[model samples]
Target: MKQFIQGIKDGGAIGIGYLSVSFTFGLAAVSSGLQWWEALLVSMMNLTSAGQFAGITIMAAAGTYIEMALSQFVINLRYALMSISLSQKVDKDFRAGRKMLLGFAVTDEIFAVAMSREGEVSSQYFAGLAVLPYLGWTGGTLAGAVCGNILPKTVTDALGLAIYGMFIAIIVPAMKKDSRILKITLLAVAFSFIVYYLPGLRNISSGFAVIICAVAASAIGAVCFPMEEEQEGA
Candidate 1:
């Protein structure tokens, strides 16, 4: 119980950090003509900043459902990898159902904090840690949606760029540490478009194309930039 409380306290930072970015998501959703409840629902349910933004971007563009799914998969692939790493650090006794539920809380910040703990993490601690952050994210989105109605059109228009700003905020710091990420990301984006241009490839389903591009890019990255230093903790 104490650990749970402590986890919640730690999670306050994650919640606070999410406020501004999730707020931008809300604004973007409204700008794209979605209802406030829909924006809130997205934040409350999805909890993925990049994936949700990409999805809304596709919707605004009148893109097909396949396009939206593919774009989200490409943009959010890192989370799947994150969940894998986090699973190793979690309590071995955690039930399958518990692990699955906790998996939803494995945002970048939560994963970092949970992994930094001194020993195997308990479900209680994780629960405490996840709840506040989830609330903060959804609350921020609702606030932004409400603000969207009253804020000047010019200001709301500029907030549209806020979505990109969220992307930059997440990417820039990581890019500084590993230049390879930028290269791989660019490679993935470039190759992922093949299904649109090549006649034979154009016949491929968007989901398959997305899977191929992401898997190939990740494989090449794993081979080319083997993480010896990170693994060795050097």
Candidate 2:
């Protein structure tokens, strides 16, 4: 119980951060033709910002199921990697079922906090940690979706850019600390630009273009800056 409460306390900052980003997602989703409740539902079902954004974009474009599935698979591949790393940090008795449930809540911020803790993370503590952020994300979506029409177009447009700022905040510090990440990020950006502007290549759908750029960049990163065995195991 104490651990649960402590987990909640630790997650407070994450919850607050999620509120703003998810608010933007809410606006984007509704403006793309989803009902307010539909926007909220998306947040409830998926806690990932990048994946959710991609999914919403695909939906708005009337993209196919294969496009949706492939886009989500590529964009959210990090979560699987994160889950694997976190598996090493849990209590011994944190069985498969509990692990599966906990996996549903493993956002990047939550994984960072969990991995930084001094000892093994208990199921109760993890559950508590997930609570506030999930609620904040969903609640913020509801607020944005319901109120988006009431706000000025200028205000909503500004809010939509907040997601980009959040992504920059997540990557910039890491990029500064690690040249490998910096290089890979730049490579991905270049690939995206090529997809956006290059002749013939520009004909690729947005969803497939994202998949191609992500896969290409990641494959290059894996080959060029492969993690040593020790780092991989960590």
Candidate 3:
């Protein structure tokens, strides 16, 4: 119980951050043609900001289901790796079912918090850790969706710019710390521009363009800048 309480307290900040990000997502989703309830449903189901944004973009572009699937699979591949890493940190008695349930809530922030702990993470602790962020994400999305419906078009459009700010905030710090990341970020940007502007490539759907840019840049980045032996061992 004590550990659970501690988890909730620790998760409070992540919850607040999620609220802000997801609120912008809600506005964008609705403004892009999704109904308010649909936007809320998206927040409830998908916790990843990047994945959600990509998915929404694909939907808005009237892309096919296969494109959506491929985009999501590529965009969210890191979570599978995160889940594998998190598995090693769980308590011995945490059964498969509990682990699976907890896996559903293992966002990047939650995984980081759990991994940084001194020892094994109890299921209760992980469950508590997930609670606030989930609620805040869903609640903020619903609020934003509702507000999108009621607010004037210009106001909603202006508020929608916040998501770009959020993405920049997330990326800039990491780029500053790692030259490899900076290169990869630049490469991805170049790929995106080429896909959007190059004569033949411009004909591709927006969704497939995203997939191509992400996969190509990441593949090149991985090949060119493999993790060091120590990091691989860790």
Candidate 4:
């Protein structure tokens, strides 16, 4: 019980940082003409910054269903990779139903925290950790939708920086642990920016750009950093 409470507390601490960025998301949704309930629904269901952002953008513009589907598919595909990685960490006895239930909460931050655990984790702990962020995300969107343009532009601009700050927070610690990861991350970021800004590539949709960058980076990393096998001494 104590550990579960601690997990919830820790998750809430990280989730508070998300509120600032989610606030901006909410405001954007409202500005795009989404109703308060609609904005809240997106946050509650998606629970992903990138996917929600892309989905709302296409939605606001009344994009076709195919476009919206592709946008969401591209943005959320990382979760599939995360799931595969996490499967290796979970107890073999973990039930399929439970895993499926918990999978909905598998965000990048959540996955990082869960993976850091040394051994088999109680589902209770994972559930506790997920609850606060889930609420914070939905609550922040609701607040933003209700507040709407009431917030000054300067405040929104500052809030917009929160997502980048969160990414930095995740990366900095990992980079400290592994210089190799740092190098890879830097290379990937540089490549992504080049592709994003290049004359011909710049014309591609942001969703497609993300897919291309992720695949290229992962492929390059795998080839450059293959695992070594050790020989046994007789």
Instruction: Give the C-alpha miss distance for residue 113 in model 4, angstroms.
Output: 1.0
Tens-digit per-residue lDDT, 100-194, candidate 3 = 77788978898888888889999889989999999999999998888788889888678667666767888899888888888988999899998
Each prediction's TM-score versus the true structure: 0.81, 0.87, 0.92, 0.69
* 1-234 per-residue lDDT for model 1 (tens digits): 998999999999999989988888888899877889989998888898878887777777677787877777777777888788777887877678998888888788888899899999888899999988999899999998888877888988887888878878876776666678877766777888765798878876555576688788878988987776365211
Q: Which ten residues in a row have the lowest lDDT in candidate 2?
A: 225-234
Better of 2 and 3 by TM-score: 3
**Model 1 off-target regions past 4 Å?**
185-220, 229-234
Better TM-score candidate (1, 2) = 2
What is the RMSD, in Å, between candidate 2 and the native fold over all Cα?
Answer: 2.6
The digit string of per-residue lDDT tens for model 2 on 57-106 reads: 89989998999999988878888898988998999877999988888999
Candidate 4 local lDDT, 135-227, one digit each (tens): 888888888878875767676556555545656775778877866677777877887899888898887665556557766775787688754
Backbone clash numbers for all candidates listed = 0, 0, 0, 0
Q: Any runs in candidate 4 off by more than 4 Å, and if so which?
A: 149-234
Give model 2's clash tally. 0
lDDT (C-alpha) at residue 14 in model 2: 94
The top-ranked prediction according to TM-score is: 3
* Residue 177 in candidate 4, Cα distance off native in Å: 13
Candidate 3 clash pair list: none
Error of 2 at 165 (Å): 4.9
TM-score of candidate 4 to 2 decimals: 0.69
